[model samples]
Target chain A: MKMSFEHRDGLGLLRVEEPRIDASVAIQFKDRFHDLTQNGTGDVILDLSQVDFLDSSGLGALVGARKLLGAGRVLELCGLTPTVDRVMVLTRMHTVFPIHPDLVTALATRAATS
Target chain B: MTGPGPIPGVIGPRPWGLTLRFAATPVAVRAALSAVDAGLADAGAPDDLRARAQIALAEACNNIVEHAYPRHPPPTEAHIRLDIAADLGGLQITLRDRGRAMPDGPLPGRELPPLDPGDIAGLPEGGFGWAILRDMTRAISLSRRNGQNILRFRLPHADKPGPLSRIVT
Candidate 1:
């Protein structure tokens, strides 16, 4: 899986272009997190529009990303499809991260607050 | 008079056309579910039924991968089978593995505890697979035979009247 990162106005938008994030790709998902956090830009917004499936391992990786962001840094998620959204809802992780409907809304909100 | 009787879980007089094999890794579990999904579709199951079946099967396969294979190196095999019935009502699935036997009591029920915002904020990282399977299917049975753990889940005929309906009508 490949993750593309774009930075605008101090918000890091990470887009994941993968169809499934189950056990088969959990390792790559973890590795991508490592690379994303290496730059120490903690204000992150993940765009999951392309991901259609996610299991526990995939959920764990997102939590791990939150931990890596440290205190006062925010990690939000955007563009969750219904299937992926259901997993987050079932696991109750939806509350842990702020979820936005789209990248434009996330960016716009961040801009308004900043 | 004819050879041995048909296998216990297998239906029909064709002498058990089903075949079961052990998939030794998590990768294999995913492959097994995909194969089963395709097979179910090819066998003329309706789209809604196939979707539910696929979701349930994926959850079960993930459980085996997470719980059964935890800490075990790759190649920890789980048994998988392809069961087909000429009569749609008798369709069944049998999944078995040599991992630690699941608790000998009844598995958890299907009702999901309501999700509170605070609880969601503190939600633990794992332990969601069983609930997913439970919610997606009507019945699940677990047993241990000869040191191998077996899990069987069945879906009733889509058009059949359920228990409550039968009682009312």
Candidate 2:
């Protein structure tokens, strides 16, 4: 569960360094992300470009991370591999989370909406 | 969602298969996925097929890890067996576990909840494992025998029906 955090323009960018975010690291992922976002004032956006695979546990962890943020904060997902995107769609997670095609696009959209 | 549809009669020994036994733990799930990656590489499976297989396998394996053991005194050693059938045209993964059976005595339905972005509480976080499996694979069969649950998932590399698919159908 390797992650790199960057702060830019009042937004927190968390890039998951691993290629597979599956059952193997689901718990660690949830815990680590929660810890990093403990004082997350700005909205957090996750970059899943390196992650080509995701399972149900991983999906649960993503939602759990969101719930951990409570109501005001936000967690967005960006740059999902096709397989990951398909799983999100099939599981109806596409509607739950705000997904962007890429990180640049995600940031731009946030800027526009904000 | 569908019942254990038709299973193949040719249940002979699979010569071109890789069997890995691991404890029902998170670390073991990674090792199992790596083993599947190796088997797919050896069989020259396409990237798309490999990706789909990994996703489905992870979901299935995780389900066993999370629910196989009783909750009261969480057993640590709920063993799981993964068998990868890589016989040229099609790929199949057979998972066996001797722990707990489905509470209702059947595979759970894989239907996802209705899409409603407005209500976050209504959106389900879990219960998406089985549905993801069905979406990824062409056929999935589950049968419990001799106190062991056997789940088989098949993915064909080519569109044309191979001998194995024909036999199964």
Candidate 3:
């Protein structure tokens, strides 16, 4: 359930420092996301490189975090592992978020645009 | 959401099979899924197959923990039992629990929650479990009897073609 947050280049970078985000930690993950990004105005990018597994509850938490960020601000995702990517595709959630291949690309793209 | 009867004959003792029981709790279900994933890897399951197995199994077991075993009153001794058997065809999974029957005495329909991009507030966070289960496994069935719920499904091996797709490429 550990997560690290950084506000850089007017973007909120939240990295989940855990291997799996399942039912056991979904609630904590959403709460932490809210706590970290509640005051930020810019878009938030979630890094899922370290997370190998994400169940439906975890997916729900991700959606919840996005709602917490509000409608105007987008909650982007990056570095989804194979399984996580599969889940996103199967659920058609990949269409909902702007996904980047990695953190560097996400940051660089955002920085270049802004 | 299709079949609702006794688990198929395929779910029985096999030399390569394993059985385990754990309390019907999120933490324990997580541990059980992790153990099963490792076991699949150890049994030489391909990455794609293993991933699908883990994902589908997680949704099913979590449903039991979330729905079958209500947390309000919290049954005295609720537990989930898993029977996993691996073969050249694929893996067979039978999940059993004695807590509560499904709401309507049948499996829930396999409809994915709508993801209306425009309606951010109306987007669904849950109800994706059944759709995920439907996508990952085959011959999935559910049955409730004697105050027990039995769920069965088969995960195909990566290299093995399914019954309908057995033609050689």
Q: Pick the candidate with the highest TM-score.
A: 3
From the highest TM-score down, the ranking of the candidates is 3, 2, 1
Give me the runs in candidate 2 sitting further than 4 Å from their true place: B1-15, B71-77, B87-89, B158-169
User: What TM-score, computed on C-alpha atoms, does each candidate reach?
Assistant: 0.73, 0.83, 0.89
Runs in model 3 deviating more than 4 A are B1-15, B159-169
Q: Which has the better lDDT: candidate 2, or candidate 3?
A: 3
Q: How much lDDT does candidate 3 score?
A: 0.82
User: B106 in model 1: Cα distance from truth in Å?
Assistant: 3.5
Give per-residue CA lDDT, model 2, range B30-117, as digits (tens): 8878887876655545677777778878888888777775463446667899987665456778999998776665565566645566
The CA lDDT of each predicted structure is 0.65, 0.76, 0.82
What would the per-residue lDDT of candidate 3 be over residues B1-169, giving only the tens digit for each residue? 2322211222322335668899888888889888887775555556787788789889998999998887844575889999987765677899999977776755665677767977788878999998778777888888888888999998876534332122111
The CAPRI-style docking tier of model 3 reads medium
Clashing pairs in 3: none
DockQ of 1: 0.20
- For candidate 1, write residues B103-145 as lDDT tens digits: 5567876443444444434445555666666655565888888
Q: Highest DockQ: which candidate? A: 3
> Which of 2 and 3 is the better model by DockQ?
3
